[model samples]
Structure formats: C-alpha cells, structure tokens
Target: MTAVLPATLAAVDLDRTLIYSAAAAGDTAGLEVVEFLDGAPLSHATPASWELLAELAGRALLVPVTTRTVAQYERVRLPVVPRYALCGNGGVLLADGVRDPGWDDWAAGVAGRAAPLPELLGLLGAVAGQPWVRTVRAAEDLFCYLVAHARDAIPAGWLADTAAAASAAGATLSVQGRKVYLVPAGLSKAAGLLRLRRLLAGEGPAPRLLCAGDSLLDAPMLLAADAAVRPAHGELHEQGWTGARVAVTAATGAAAGEEIVRWLIARA
Candidate 1:
C-alpha cells in the first residue's frame, strides 16, 4: 500500500463517476445518446449529492481528474468550477478553469520521455495482427485505443503481454469495453493528483484522499486514495472494489453517479 498522505483530497474520474456522457458504450462515444435525444442525459446532481459535493468543496479541495482534453472537458461542462482539475490523463492542469503555468512545464518535461503517436501506431499495427481488431482511434491528446469485435480473438493473456511490451516502450495499455488504450507511461491521473496533494500538504494534516472510477485504467487513482467508491458497472466492479467503501448503484451510468453523491452525503 502507498503511504498515507498528510493532507487529504478527492480525485474523481469524470466519465461515469460524476457525469455520464451521452455515449456510454465503449465502442462508440456516447454522442449518439445525445444526438437522439435533444442533448446528453446529464441530470443535475441529486439535491443531497449536490449538497455533499458542496460540503466537500468547502471542507477539502475537489479535483476533477479525468482523461479529457481541456477542449473536450470544456464541452461537457460541470455544474460548478473545481478548485483544481487534471485533464487529458494528467496532460493538463487547470486551477479554477484557467490552465496552470507550472503544469505546462510539468507536461512538457514528461512528454519528452513518452513515445510519439506514429511510433505507437506502428506498434499497434504490428502486434494486433488479426481481423478481430476492428478500429483504432486516438482520444483527445491522451493516446490511441483499439476496438476489437471479437473478445476471444486476443486472449487475456496475450493482452497482458502486449500491454507489458507497450509499457516497456514507454506506453501503457488498458482494455476498456471493446477497446485497448495505449497511453504514455507518464500519463496517469495519480501523478497529477499527487502533485496537487503536495501543493496543499501545508494547509493541514494531509487530507484523506477519496476517489472513484470505472475501469482498470482507474485502478491507480483508486488505490492511491485514502477512501474510495466504485459503481455497479466497470472493470473494477468485476475485480471487486478495494477502496475503503463501495457504493452499489443502479445498473445505468447516470444512476450510479447519483449513488456516488448519496454515498458522500451519508458519510458527511
């Protein structure tokens, strides 16, 4: 286990954690859900959940740590501004909606060591030698993910080995839904979150860290928190949640978010 910190904070994954995008399916961005209806299914945070988040906002800092680029993040829109945000899998840091200068230097320093997209694409093509591998696309400045039509096409063991190979080459591979992400080894929600925690350590005994996420990619952040929550669905659910507490919510993504808010309120 990582050492407990001196100050506490909440590091939450945005999609399916606090907000459910229109595209809930892994193969397709939730865009269709929004397009079919007039807009996406973003119900306002339940009153109790909103109150709890507000309480956390005042008592301890709330950071929206997500795998979204600043531009994409700007589009979904949040109910309230967070004190700090880690965007694009820690590629960018924002303080009160404005990009932080220090983080720019940090991103540049880290990006220098990561593999470029062209190299990553080549590796993906070389290793993923099968017709089952249907589509591959890049996420907003984070990295590329491959969608497979046949789950049995690549054995889980092969996926593990492939991920290890990618990591050795300075990238990470995380399978979510029908896709596998090739993220830079340096890009993680935990890295950016630890940086924010360090900045606030002097304020009080390191605040307890609380986090929530849906996939294996989120495992690092979830494990790093002082306490955490996991929804009914997601890779973490199948493996079981190791956080201090787990919230079993409705099967749907939007309903799970409501459960998260309720969990905070009950504890608060």
Candidate 2:
C-alpha cells in the first residue's frame, strides 16, 4: 500500500505575479489575453502558464489572493475558476463569485479596530494636492490608493510622512509600481487566506499552504504560508524582502508567471 499525502492549498497573487499587463508583458507575441476592459486587452499570461495553472488547480485548492477590488478581479478570466478569492487586500471574500456574508460581518468587526476610512481619505486628499499626484481612489470602501505621475517624482520624505500618518491611524502605507496604498492594519491577505483554509479544512484534512506573490502587500500571506515563492520583479523584490521558506523565480515578466505555476505543481 502507498502512503497517502495530504492535500495542499495554494494562494497566489494575480497582478505582476501570475499575470501581466501589456506594459509588463515582455515579448507579447505568444501571450494569451486573460483580462479585458471594453473589449481592449488589459492583462495577459503566457500559454504555458495557463496550462500549468490548470494542472496546479487540479492538484491542489488554488485561491487567488489579490489587492484588487471584486469588480476588478472579476475582469480576470483564469483557466481554472477558484472556489474562493481574497480581494480588496482581504477586505472582501468571494465564494464562487458571490460575496460571503459571514466574511462581510467579520470584516466589519475588523474594521472597527482601525481608523476610519474618512480620516485616511483626508490625509490622501492633502497628498493629492502635490503636483506629482495623479489620482486618488477608494477601494471597496475599505482602503484608499493614489496614482502618481511618476513614482520617482514622489518625494521619499513625503512617502515616509504618509507611512507615519497611516501607522498612527492603525493602517499601513505601501507603494507598488506607481500606486500608493493606505491599508487598514487589521485587514490582511493572510487573514483572509487563513479563514478560507479553516473552512476548507472542515471538509477534510488540513492542507499544506503554498503562496506566491510579488508585492509588499503580499508579504503577510507569504510569511504565513508553509511555503512561498516570488518573482524577481515587483515591489517585494525591489525591497529585497525574503524569508526562510520563500523561493524566488529566476525569470521576470510573463515568464516568471509560468515559472511560478510550474513551481507550485512541483511543490504540490
């Protein structure tokens, strides 16, 4: 008789990790469109990645953990539909494309422990007055983010000041690519993933957790996982963020997405 291995749970970030936008998709010739807006191509993944993702999904429970809003995440069409998704930086949970009311109630309780959105928005308003600030928008009514004309043009001191303010208000500030995020301290991707893991475990044995991401927002999730992987590009890599169990892919761009999928299948 052969020993049976326990099931595995894989949580993955979408943007710049498993998928890439046109600007980030190097050598787009063979890339397949994964997202579209108004019939215009928005994001893509390599064909090889799609095939590997399907295989990985079959081998383990795959959950998309992203900072994107529910509406934004819905735009993405993956080869395999995840049974659960963590969106809005863990502010919202979706089960089979529908919002989970229990998760909503839990998020409300968590939100009570953090500074109000209005206060954060006020701070963002002040920062938006700067010439380098392009636009500021709220996400899922849970957090706020700012787009800069040029990330380099934004003063380092200003970012530091914003971070301090957010910290004082029980929130965290993160800059990824050209966007600045003001996330409430109580909400995190790890929390959402853990909750989902518990729910899944109730159905069977607890699965080993594997995560992959490419940004600072994903740090908590990666840290919480049994094993994690990251691409060579994105905010986390630029910051030199690493951990004992975290492995980095050799390639960048869409190729990195494929590499991550292949790694997940092998690990599973």
Strongest candidate by TM-score = 2
Query: Per the 3 Å backbone cut-off, how many clashing residue pairs does candidate 2 have?
Result: 0
lDDT of 1: 0.66
lDDT of 2 by residue, 74-169 (tens): 999999888778999887989888998888888877766778998988778897878899999988888899989877887898889999999999
Candidate 1, residues 111-220, lDDT tens digits: the string is 55777776776666765567788876666545677778755576687687777778877988776556677888787888878777776665545667778788776778
Q: lDDT of each prediction vs. the true structure? A: 0.66, 0.88
Error at 137, model 1, angstroms: 4.4
Lowest-sum lDDT 10-residue window in model 2: 1-10
Question: Model 2: runs farther than 4 Å from truth?
Answer: 1-6
